[model samples]
Target: MSRDIRIVTEAQLREVVSLDLETVDVIEAAFRALAGGGVVMPPILSMAIEEAHGEVDVKTAYVPGFDGFAIKVSPGFFDNPKIGLPSLNGLMILFSATTGLVETVFLDNGYLTDIRTAAAGAVAARHLAPSDVAVAGVIGTGLQARLQMQAAHLVRPFDRCLVWGRDPARAASCAADIAAATGAQAEVMTCPASLCEQSQLVVTTTPATEPILTAEMLHGGLHVTAMGSDQGGKNELAPQALARADLYACDRVSQCETLGELRAARAAGLMPDTPPELGEIITGMATGRTHDAQITICDLTGTGVQDTAIATHVAARLGGAGTVIPV
Candidate 1:
């Protein structure tokens, strides 16, 4: 007896999936499931290729009720743009949860990761940001920066967007792109502090080894989602900033302590005690924003459960649209 496995290309996946409210809901459910327990997720297997200025990470998870699990291989080469190549690319393999057999191969080339990551930002904003967000700011001008703004807008509509980056030209370009795509007034800010002062919601998406956002920039009635410190040695916000937040949450407490901004805070003796995970807040196990004046921060260190959720979703949406091979 043989089984069939579907091969879905990046183009096919793009046609079925996008960074929209539907995808955000899918990721939100994954976080809820994570909080509900019975989800088995393993530590990420990561490697660094110093000579090439690149790193690769492999992650997977098995949800009890899900039909399949996904193993995603993601690579990020920061220097790729110098040669006109993309900075990130990868694929995901979905396998039957019960049978442990291959089910679908998604050659998404990191597209799914991008969508789910941006969706996670939206989830953070939906649950933590102030209800009446007039301005939103993003600290980096990369793909995630643009997508994070768009995704956040889906949940918390803002009147304007502030963009900041190391490269002024790129920041200006990103602002223009956001204005064109989101129909929101977008402008480039010279500094992160200035952006934070005016925006009610701020997202840090840079891979900066040094701190770009500091405690002094934190103000009342603000929510910050720091998603760039997914790897070790990457610190976007100063440790004091985390300590200053009225509420600090993590996508996964353990992962954030090791890879996200929490790592730096812990090392600096700032956040001595463990904070609640995002799943906890989403499932009502923990409290979210209680008052509009609360300063909230969420550390999103990408999780394997999210990959499993999005991959399963894409597989279903394909609905037998890909090439089938028997094994």
Candidate 2:
């Protein structure tokens, strides 16, 4: 007896998928399913290579209703750019839920992860940010900083964008890129505090051990999505900032406590009680932003369910586009 397997390349996946409203909805539904329960997901297995400034993570999840599950291997080599390579790259393997056989191998090289991550940010903003956002800001100049801004725009539709980073030239370039891509007025800010003060929505996309967005920067009618703190020792928001927000949400409470911003908050004794997960809000199991003046924050540590959902979705869309092999 032999089995057939499909191999989908990054190019094929790129042709069929994008960071659009539909993609956002798919990721959002994954969260809803997670909140609904019956989803089997494990904690991420991460390895850090200090000498190389690189890290790799392996994640997998199985949703009850889905026909297939995905196991993803993602690697981030921060110093790759010095040699003209991308900082992030990885692939996903999709397996049949019934037989646990490999159904497809997606050579996406972290493209799907990038999309789902940005889409998750949009989901957070959609439920937490003020209904009317005049200015949106990002606190990094990386690829996620750009994708997150675009993703939020799909849901919040801001009029202006503020960009800030450690490097002035990179920040200016990021602002110009945002302006050109989204046709919105984008400006480079000197500091994160100024950006947060003026923007209704802010996203932190940097991998910094020290806090970049602090408590003093938070204000009424503000929504912050901290997506950079997915590994232990990565702290983006000041611990007290979580306590200050009217509501603070996490993609997954346990994962956040170990790897995300919640870890810092818990260590600082600011968050004693567990906060609501993003999935709870999506499924109405918990409350979201109720008033425009309330300040809300969502801590997103990438989840395995997102990878499974996105991989399943991509496999469906591939639909005979990739090469097939039998074993």
Candidate 3:
């Protein structure tokens, strides 16, 4: 194999990996691959800069049948908006599946990460949420919130949507974006309780150190996807909320213990030592949403498998071999 590498720019990657059912399936396949247990994935490498209100994470995974894998570098600087910069930016490097050659580089600036995260939320809803949904809700007015709503609509069409944020103006803007993106009537909710009450499918995407949605806020048959807590000490859903859920699942149990909704639940002694992984459900090794009246919670801490899957898929789309990157 040659040492030369292909560079896929953010714009090029966006055109290839659009937020649609196909891309969502790619993300789901990554989960299935994880559940199957042949992939080699290390614990995420993370660092925090408290002074800058920023954090960086490095993740990678190698699936047995895939031709290549990707190592993604994701940086989140929450304070960037103060200087008119986006909060998230990063890139991914794809390596050959054989002979350890460099394959392609995706300068996505975290766009692929955002897309896969939202798609994972939708996949969780598809396999767990009640068949019929009236209103879908999202808490937090960030990029993930809007993408979550858009992706959820791909699986289950909701009559309307409710978006909640601490800032009323931001919530309203997010609601408008959801309406435009998904063609669903979207409104801003002042409180998480009201949003939860009005929604059957809810996603929480806030980087709060303290809990936001409580068990009291959830009702029967509600499905919650919490995708914000990807770092230690970060939390969004209350421990009691996770404890009381009829079914609890995370992207990975190991990561959840250190940096997900389940972490808080375990710390408070509200949950068991092991919860089912979402991949298990997707692969049919475990059950998901057996009853319509069940309450389900999915805690996503992000995974390296996702980066590898999306990168491999994109690489093929942009001219890599169909089977695997040739050495």
Candidate 4:
């Protein structure tokens, strides 16, 4: 191989890695890899600044059979919108699996993260949610909230979607954008409970410090995908909501215990009995929803396996575009 690293910008990556069914399949396979112990992943290195309302996380994993691994740095500053900036930004570095040489540097500025996360949500829904979803719901008006719905449609096409946000104006805007993009009727919901009552699949994408989706809001045949809590203090689902679910799975049990919704549930003395990992379900090691009325929950704390899988997929797509880098 020649000695030249391929540097991809966010715009370039947008041309390749889109939020579609293909990406969702890739993320699903990554979870299966995690379940089979085919990847070497470490706990996320996370830091939070309470005063600034910001957090930074570093995650990476090496799938032994894959050609490359990705180290991702993701930062979230909740105050950025006030300064006319996006709330999330970061990048990833791809290294060769064999030589550990830098093969690609994706200056995606969190675009890949956004793609993989949305795709992960869709994957979770595909495996855990009901086969036929009439109505979909999103809790939050942020980018992930919109992306989650878009991605979910790739698997279970919903008739319409409901969006709820603290700011009604933002929620309306979100509904408009989603409607324009997917040609689906979108409306602003008054509360999370109302949305849950009407929708079978609901995704929570808020950086909330308090629980947003509680047990009283959930009913039979409902599936919840909680993707917001990636740090210790961030939580979106009430402990009772999880404890009441028929099937409660997480991307990673270890990470969920410390950083995902499970952490909050445990702290509240509401731990579910023998919760399985989402990977286990993906790999068929565990059952997902056995009955139509069974309530299911998928806690996605964001995993390095997702980064590795996406980065590897992107690199393969860039086969002719990427130059060989020497060790």
Question: What is candidate 4's TM-score against the reference?
Answer: 0.95
Tens-place lDDT digits, model 1, residues 157-232? 8989999999999999999999987889999998999999999999999989999999999999999999999888
Q: Please estimate how well model 2 matches the true structure, expressed as its whole-model Cα lDDT.
A: 0.94
Residue 57 local lDDT, model 2? 95
Q: How far off is model 4, as Cα RMSD? A: 1.9
Model 4 C-alpha lDDT versus the unseen true structure: 0.91
Query: Mind giving the per-residue lDDT tens digits that candidate 4 earns over 1-327?
Result: 458788888988888779988999999989989999857888888888779988898999988778889999998898999999887888999999898888899988899999999999999999989989989999999889899999999998998999999999999999998888777899999999999999999999998999999999999989999999988888999998898888899999989999899999999888846688988997789988998788999999999999999999998887555334454
For every candidate structure, what is the RMSD over all alpha carbons to the true structure, in angstroms? 0.9, 1.0, 2.8, 1.9
Decoy 3 TM-score against native: 0.95
- lDDT per model vs. reference: 0.95, 0.94, 0.90, 0.91
lDDT by residue (tens digit), candidate 3, 1-327 = 234667778887766678899989999999999999888999999898999999899999999899998999999898999999998999999998787777787888998898989999988999989999889999999989999999999998998999999999999999999999999999998899999998999999998999999999988989999999987889999999988899999999999999898888888888975888999999889888899899999999989999999888888888642223333
Ten-residue region with minimum lDDT total, candidate 4: 318-327
lDDT of 3 at 316: 81
Cα distance off (Å), candidate 1, residue 22: 0.8
Point out where model 1 deviates above 4 Å. Answer: none
Clashes of each: 0, 0, 0, 0
